[model samples]
Target: MTAGPAEALHSWMPHSPCGAWCLPTGDALPKVSPARRALRLATLVAVVLTGPLCALTLSVLGPRGRAAVIRGWFRMVLGALGVRLRVYRPGALSLAPEERERPRDRGVLVVGNHSSWLDIVALNALQPVRMLAKAQVRHWPLIGALAARAGTFFVDRPRLSTLPATVAEVAGALRGGAAVGVFPEGTTWCGQATGRWKRAAFQAAIDAGVPARPVALRFVVDEQCTTAAGFLGEETLLTALLRTAALRGLVIEASVLPLVSPEGHDRRSMAAAAEAAVTEALGQPEAEHAVPEVAAAA
Candidate 1:
């Protein structure tokens, strides 16, 4: 059998450690003026210093209190960076009719397209969420400390032995009515295309018997995709941050799609449905799963 579209298209490129989406046209760095860069740097320093302190304060607070504090910080950060956000709730986009009608008692597993680190800030601006991040993030200086305080689940992907335990921890959080965020694609690609989403996070939703909500994230500036915001390739976190902060009139559009039920559902099928929703929302061609090279070669 021939490789599927996703496979045929994506097989050539290697996965990136930092989240990045690849575009067909290629990557072009965004230009930031000296004055704007200086201003943005100052603003970032203030936000970075304040984020951890707020995390410490919210640690002892109730869920409502913590969420309020987080949202306030997100707004401040976005304002300073000149990044506006447009959130489309159910029905406004291609979401299913029943999306808004679903029972939200149980915490939801939110999966999305990961293109830039800014995606995290944008989503948190929507609400406080516990993120499932890679283990490398756990070592990122002040950001790591703040992320830990915010209750991020860090997984060491290379150590497959720990996956079951990590899944259990994520499932426990979901069962407790805490919304969990994950980039199931494991690696970031340019937003122009998406990769195969891993099924582990979906399994956590299944274990908790909660629904998975697929959110589509896109960064736009001057009515075009802001690929410079992505963290892929050789770009460091600091570089991505600087580029994002220097952006003018940057708008983050987060379109929340329908929630897929985990009850009596298989992880693979659930992931596929979520992927399709996100692909359509982002205006990208849906990729068919590719056959493994070893299998295809046979």
Candidate 2:
């Protein structure tokens, strides 16, 4: 997840908001009070409600039902966070007539440029998606528990053997009509740099024989709401969110571009196509500015 670009990619682009807006530092943005408070209250409600509701619902329904419950739960979390989603026109699903004719048209994998954990809430609120998170996230205290309950697919990068199995699980999930979510950037950023698009996760959609839809996310807030200190570095889950929302006002935009079929194309081409669409939607005029050169994941 980037504020926008990694340093190398940032170098390639012409002029960028990265230099002007991004703090010269670590993996976060300046925290604002209103945003921090809004996020905290929303997360608190989600923590309180998700457990009981997800428990009853997941227990009663089958896997599909449970997944739907997770979708609703995530939407609730986004609403609590005071996030409003805006989609650019012509950014709708790229489905044929027959696909649109049916009600159960399976949702595709939502491949995105990740910025913050907030990206999760933003996508969940705006799209039909279930996120793919790191295996270590499952061990985190409160948020980890919620992720597990939501049936999040956690990947362990260190274990080579587990990678295929994990990918297989995600493929199965996608075939079963779940919209898989992935952050191709691989790491969180300080709302500044853009990141390289990871090829592996996009391969999952190709392997599953489904479309890998592009989604671009950006953090925008009233100046009164964001601050340098609270969001400057690696901060705790509760404290960071609370302080940012309490002071900063935040609105995350989720614009989904057309789906790219995995058939007969390379990963880089797919990435370029998605990047172009997202960049245009975000109102960045230049292509080189929109698509960053390959960089090791931040």
Candidate 3:
């Protein structure tokens, strides 16, 4: 019997070459005490419980008011997780303050590297853009509820045939002057390595005639880069959350690079350009950036 698109998609799911080997284990990583971890977890739950109230409050606010509330909520989420966030605009550093703030109002396609669930929190904290999330994320506990309320675009990976429609939906949102976030790698990896970019999401930018903005995300602990926060391999989400909560002095650096125009570029070239921009911002040598051949096949 021939396999259906759903079955084929299950088999075609992207996988990273990064695993336990890419992460720091045992004494090599700095950790907070069990008591501290418990405190962080409790605080996180408290903050999440306020999501419904926040959503209700947001419905009555104007655009500026809504953005303010969303930013505060996401910042509180990062604080609850005991993670520090630092946002940098490498491309706009030389520009005047007013010039640097201009892009915030534009509808651009935001693309970036994915390493942990924190990536979502950190990016949304920077600005309340609609993110492209896997369909399963829409069913997660409190997190899923918050994502749905925040206008996240959920992609059904199993329904591979629906991709064009998904892209069209995203394009329509972009055309309406909303920034859409996507991780074209389509899978999470340890911060030490990354996967190849998939071109499907980039098509939305081309279709909407919007620029693609590449952002680089890095997780640092105790002044050194670490993959302790990564949700990789067979690790459960609970395990990853606990691990992140226990880490001391963890900082997530998000660098916003210059935008890549979709004009005169096809989806493949546009995706490659965005990937190259992110890779450069990450400061990794070309050889150090890992692209699993298996992921490309997927």
Best by lDDT: 3
Best by TM-score: 3
Could you give candidate 2's per-residue lDDT for residues 1-298 as a string of tens digits? 1222222243222222332143323535544365457656867575655566565667788755765666566656655655544444241244565433213546477877654666777676555466887676888766688778666898765455676788788888887777888876665544445556666666667777777777766655542222232232334556556543442345554555557777776667776677666656655422222323111101
TM-score of 1: 0.82
lDDT of 1 at 113: 89
* Candidates 1 and 2 compared by TM-score, better number: 1
TM-scores of the candidates are 0.82, 0.71, 0.88
lDDT of 3 by residue, 115-193 (tens): 9888887777877889998887788887789889889988877788878999999999988889888988888888677
Which is better, 1 or 3, measured by TM-score?
3
Candidate 2 ranges with C-alpha deviation above 4 Å = 1-49, 61-69, 91-107, 222-233, 283-298
Candidate 3 weakest ten by summed lDDT? 289-298
Q: lDDT of each prediction vs. the true structure? A: 0.73, 0.58, 0.79
The positional error of residue 196 in candidate 1, measured at the CA in angstroms, is: 0.8
Error of 2 at 254 (Å): 1.1
True-structure lDDT of candidate 3: 0.79
